[model samples]
Target: MTWKTKVNSALEGITGYTIVRPRPQAPPPKDTPRPPADPKIDRLLRAPVFVLSPVRSGSTLLRVMLNSHSRIHAPHELHIRRIAVSLTTEPVRQAMDALGHSPSDIEHVLWDRMLHRELVASGKDIIVDKTPSNVFAHRRISTCWPDARFIFLMRHPASIAGSWHEADPQERPMEEAVRHTLQYMRYLQEARRRYDGLDLRYEALVDDPEGEMRRVCTYLGIGYEPGMIEYGRHDHGEFVKGIGDWRDKIRSGRVQRGRPLPAPEDVPEDLREVATAWGYLQES
Candidate 1:
């Protein structure tokens, strides 16, 4: 690579550059003082909301509905928890040093700054990041932003355990499915207990998006708009890449609620207590 190319690639972690035209020999135009950036936007580091859940828990559906709102910029799966975790370590600092950037500079350029740009593009001020696996990273997020709010999206453990590749789990080992469900339950239980957030059930959301989203908007201190029901009218841009099951449903512009859950036996005995605690029945 040429020296310029090498330099650009090495500094790619830095913020994007802007170009300006040279002023001609004529006197420069009178300099008008620039307006101060909005204080709320300037300090919008903490996410307004995170739809934290496990796979197939209807997070995409909820995101589409919320994104349709005029003031909420709910985006697709960013998987930022992993990035959030990495940013808190020494390696991220070392990489920033190599790129001639500071820790906050690199982090701002990558995460909060990018989200703010997207939020502005969407003509919204609130950012709602929906990454299903973020349930496991609640502590990390809380540590970074003590006021981080979450929409703890959940489905019945048996329903999630029974779903994989859109396939019926009857042919697979039930133990493996139950194991995965148990882990998510543990995380959800802990997150619900530890954080300052809302617990929203996927079944309830899909059942009545209008009512659920109205409550959600009220919780987030935003007024509800009718446009949220027309989520399919918007282009979320690869919002369903890793979550294909939701693509058609989101595009259809209609709420698709979950079916009757599998028998209680589908959930492992150990997880029954969690299910009950979360308001799902323990019986088959």
Candidate 2:
């Protein structure tokens, strides 16, 4: 079986959320009353959010949960930061019709425009993007929006690696796991060093979504809403069908708390600092 199958099978065994693709649906009702907004929260809502993580680490699931909130527009991967990284001076200048803008400003324009459109269409003010590749663009995103929030979502190394191999079983499983896990850890470490945001573990989320999401709402300066846990059942947007089967369960429109599967060997000694920092290890 594909490594993806292993991950899907294990997750499916515990709770049964099946894959439901995003189809055309009526508008999501906006009847949730808004509480008084803090000026601090007002500022935060104006800034974009980059939900960073490696692929198949449950970022999509997190996005839907956050989107269940009254104001937050947590959408599927848009990879805005990736666009920032790919920009060149000349193209940016040309796009601006000779208007003066720093490279950072140009990238910000790109991010802002896309987010503005999405938020407008959704009738929500805040935009949360769950692009695992956004870690690549974190620096530029921060440069553009100094107050931007970075949420690092983490799953166990074993599950992440197993899922990776299942997506494409031809690759060397150990190398893929070690390389991607360490890379994600590096970004998480740097983000902790540089930014003020939350570091949430996937395990914690599945274990106690209410408590974990409450903590997240606190971090984001928003009140906790019980709707966040029932995100899977609501129609936030068209469901995203991604590579492999890891995301199918969340598409079932309800969060299913999965039973713990066997964990891979602890992270290697050299990388244990970050692994431990992210709550993935106790010791080297």
Candidate 3:
């Protein structure tokens, strides 16, 4: 069986799995309200969150909020964590050993060596690797660290398209947006397929900032502090400046230009389904 299948098989043994592909149906109307917590769900107190979602999809916004919490110190999108985990995990280590490397060499070449080098290079801890592509490897990641928490950030496709167009006018905006949304969608689906009882929270953080942040922290097993709601007001330049010169970009916009593209109302009808699946009110 393929590694993915094996992982899926292993996950089947666990109960209370929640795979959210295509985003959970727009939580009943605002008043209907979904249950905030389930007894079966394991509380992940202060567990590091691997914020996985598409780029330009409010990821930075979510990261900044978590960073604002006194207990959290999230850096910008540092992809090296997944790489570190992949190279150091026991199964991966065994594969390397089978390929003929001394234990000392493997230890030096794998975990301690590269991770320490990168951590020092960046100078951060309580690290959060916020990469959209990380979702692509969620199965491996969940298998590697079963208790790890995930928060998937989603944005309306039209807004995602607009943001992409604003960032670089070269690409076909609509196409890029659809492609981006689908990539994360498939990852969410696959993660559910592979990890039976994975603890993941998916939110359209841009839509309901306060409510989502509360649920996100709850899933992370952290208390809901008011500070998390105003992270955008803080100066996150220390870690924010590193990703795509985003600090400069955020400074350029006249309006409140947070990471997530605003909900799109101008999206063409043909493409409205994409936004709907992405968890946004349909554009008429």
Candidate 4:
């Protein structure tokens, strides 16, 4: 007999069962349409804002600036999309179904409640979550809060990759940085294409903080406050790693000028398309 046959026969004789490996579970379906918000099921938190951006795109700076506003509370990156629920038992699943709740619906309720709690605790009229990874779940976010607003934060693709590599050069080499950060750029671009939102660039924001803040305030239907430009005076929580930008530049507590954009010729071939699309490079 072959080695496999012998091993299986021996295992069956010893344990009364043959070796069986479990099959890999498939990923959940994508873009499943969530029902529009129902008054009875969803409440609390109105016209919440989301800053969709890639990693190392200066979202933290924007967050703190907006947070300094009297009426806006831009909190640290709250990765609510990563939070999930599981129907562990049949009874629990049945109960949810009886209540006309799908798994997604329950999770949406939890996400809403969490943000509402934050907004209430801060005593602010508006809440903004600037989690970069949220670009992947733009659809779900739009569905969860029909009145949600978005700010599409754009940075030069070459700058994003260079900064990402510098953030952890040993772990993120230049080559890998382009590949990894490009995913966010693509998703951010797709969200921009599919959604209606204000587009702001990292370069312009730093060069003209007051001008951009005024524009943003206008979009949100609020008067621009001068304090937003002086965000260094506010206590915007701990500038720790992971949740958001935790580098010295962010810790500087000022709107520092962004790095000069790479020349068109210096832009990496891999990033050329996106850089041009984002208006960082002129189309030939």
What lDDT score belongs to each candidate, Candidate 1 first? 0.69, 0.69, 0.54, 0.91
By TM-score, who's the top model here? 4
Writing each residue's lDDT as its tens digit, candidate 2 over 1-284 gives 99977877777777666754457655423222222133242222366777777776788788889999988997767756556423334465466546544454455566667777888888877788887766766776676566678888877665666566676666756666667767765775677677877888888898889999999889888899999998866676676455212456866877777547544354445455655676667654
List residue ranges in candidate 1 displaced over 4 A: 1-43, 84-109, 168-173, 243-247, 282-284
Report the CA-based lDDT of candidate 2 relative to the real structure. 0.69
lDDT of 1 at 115: 66
Give residue 107's lDDT in candidate 4 (0 to 100). 81
Q: What digit string (tens of lDDT, one per residue) describes model 4 on residues 57-83?
A: 989999999999999999999999998
Q: Rank order by TM-score, top first? A: 4, 2, 1, 3
lDDT of 1 by residue, 120-205 (tens): 88877788887767777777556445556888888887777766424555555667767766777789789988877888998888
RMSD to the true structure for each prediction, in A, is: 13.3, 19.5, 17.5, 5.2
Tell me the deviation in Å of residue 270 in model 3. Answer: 8.1
lDDT of 1: 0.69
Which candidate do you rate higher for lDDT, 1 or 3?
1
User: How many clashes in candidate 4?
Assistant: 0
TM-score, cand. 3 vs. native: 0.57
Q: Is 3 or 4 the stronger prediction by TM-score?
A: 4
lDDT of 4 at 85: 80
- Please tell me which model should have the higher lDDT, number 1 or number 4: 4
Which pairs clash inside model 3? none
- Candidate 2 TM-score versus the reference: 0.72
